[model samples]
Target: MAAQLSEIEVKGVKIPLIYEKSTLMPAVNLQIVFTHAGSITDEIPGLASLSARIFNEGTKTLGSVEFAKELENRAISLSVGSGNETLVFDMSALKSEYLEGLRLTRELLRQPNFTKEALSKVKTDIKASLLRKESDFDYVAQVELHRRLFEGTPLEYPSMGNRESIEKITLKEVEEFWKKRGVLRRAIVLVGGDVELEEVKKDLLSLLSVLPLGEEGELVRYEAKGDLEVKSVIKNTQQAYIYFGSPFSVKNLREDSYKAKVAAFVLGSSGFGSRMMEEIRVKRGLAYSAYWRISLSKSVNYSLGYLQTKLENEQQAIGVVRELIEEFLQKGITEKELEGAKQFLLGSEPLRNETLSQRLSSAFSAYYRGLPLDFAKEELHKIEALTLEEINAYIKEHQELLQLSFSVVTAPKE
Candidate 1:
């Protein structure tokens, strides 16, 4: 039987639940998020990501191979990934297999094996991936940009600890880290699709309640120092990948961040309609692709734009991008542009939460950020309410902070 969506209070914690009655085969998506445990503290820099990686490596009763085979045989999809401030574990399976899926998830969370063999495989894979990243121009540029921006903060370290760091990690260290940081006391488990609220809560509590509670700690804050400026490094390739931005904190703007986002979209985010696309692709054809994005963190915020073009035309592309940004900052986007960007945002918003998987993912994101469940929708409403004058005013306020950064990969001259 399919269950209806409802909110429930469990042991003083308010949990949001979503359920849909399906005529087709019953399917369920479950996401569990651990808050306050995902921080990149100086002591265990990559602890969150590492813990998530080792979750499925092995469990109490199942060895690595056996555990993997079990999920495959059951047609279960399980994923564990972490971000700056949250660690997430997601499971999707048919309702008929729901009990089995929950059992496996509980065992994996409570009793991960963290064997030496599994750790070795993870280390080897990470090292190979890092080597591959070295040859990627865009990757190199983005890594450098983060290093420069974050500087001394623990957040500066790559999510996948470097080769040296990963090599140093041992099974014992992983176990200790897991014990100290993997407590599910503050975790939120969301079950979507055909699921009974009581059943879901009962299952989660059975596994999560046994874990000992730990001291609640504050999230690490990273402060960006100095003025934003352009930095470049030369690499051997035919095209250049450029990135530009300045210090802009999303937390500071809150709901008002919509204006900044809309401005960015009008300026360079919209592939074809964006100003950068007009100048760099349509008018001059210096590059076939150009776009910009805004990245927000608890303590850090910045905008980045990039394009790829031949070595000879790289300089032209960079110049045009800079010029267009300068013009946008000075004059601001027109009323028509703002309207179009808002409509694009409004139309795109629904697609983001259209599916069970997406909604569950979004719920995790909200829990991670300490945002209201309706933050996405509210943000869209804010975007629709923004006026051209306000956006232009925002551009003027942020113009002086704009900094252009570039990384170019070019082929050697014949």
Candidate 2:
């Protein structure tokens, strides 16, 4: 399918880039990202997402149930989700429902009630969710990892706050968070598939006109301390979940970042071919499943690689993982491994952009992170262009920088 990219400027708000695809099925993907500083971070880390959820719960005229029913009636899927840096509200619907969907979305964004009842329900739901997380070994491990890695920083807290924080939150607090950070800043709205550009622009303006523009707040910059610490969570279970890693931040989409990504895939990310999978699962039979993930934070340019394994081989597993990591760091990756990583990354690129939702979401994230709208495409190119020497150099530079953190879920020894 042929694609054309274009930009639209309305008033002071500039819609960065839009990719239009001519298809038989009519579909529109819109991404609206709001930029607000972390004022609410002091109270609750994920206050931005909490505020977005409350806004969707009810507006001035529609109650929670009514709003949901209206959305269902239109066969529209409205999703309110966020990342560490921004809150994103995405909508997908047929051409016929686009106008109404946009209208309802605008109402929810501009006229949220933030009523006491809504706040109570949200807190109650969050508390219940937290209760359920207590028994989840993987969740425990991940949470402990963040706590150790980002100690004393606002990013140390989970995106979903703890039960005590949630319980203490009030409607007034929610309102204050909204007023301080939710109203206006830089907002990007993306609409794709079978839509008139002019109409979409008008719809966006109508909703955005009600929002007041003010001095954009300074961006919150997070710096990762190179200190690595270990933590353990005691629980009465047969298996334990363990994670360990170090701070690897990508500041400017550098070659090191790309090499690190490729190296991580060879080390753990590709599921079957990764070194972690081969050693932990295939060779040793130590874990039922073992893999690694590369988490990138655009605002802070922080990236971390994590390895999750079961408790039976917790100590041994960490030891073996560390040894392999040390070897990679010292000797660096081979030509064969680099080639395999590149192929795996290039093969997976298409999957990332397979759906309209993925495309729009990726575009929004790229723009939000101060990257080109074609960041994904660029990433693929970068991966393809990587050399074995560069990958080896990255490993040589960062091998000793690794950190270890633990979360154990096991019964006490007799």
Candidate No. with top TM-score: 2
Error of 1 at 303 (Å): 1.2
Residue pair clashes in candidate 1: 237-410, 237-411
lDDT of 2: 0.68
Candidate 2's residue-wise lDDT over 217-287, tens digit each?
Answer: 66666655555445577787677677665666563553455666887788778887888788888998877
Go through the candidates in order and give each one's C-alpha lDDT: 0.70, 0.68
lDDT per residue as tens, model 1, 177-227: 667656545566677767666677677666565555654457766654434
CA deviation > 4 Å runs, candidate 2: 1-22, 37-42, 226-229, 301-312
Model 2 RMSD to the real structure? Answer: 2.6
Q: Using Cα atoms with residue i matched to residue i, what is each candidate's TM-score against the true structure? A: 0.89, 0.91
TM-score of 1: 0.89
**Each candidate's root-mean-square deviation in Å?**
3.2, 2.6
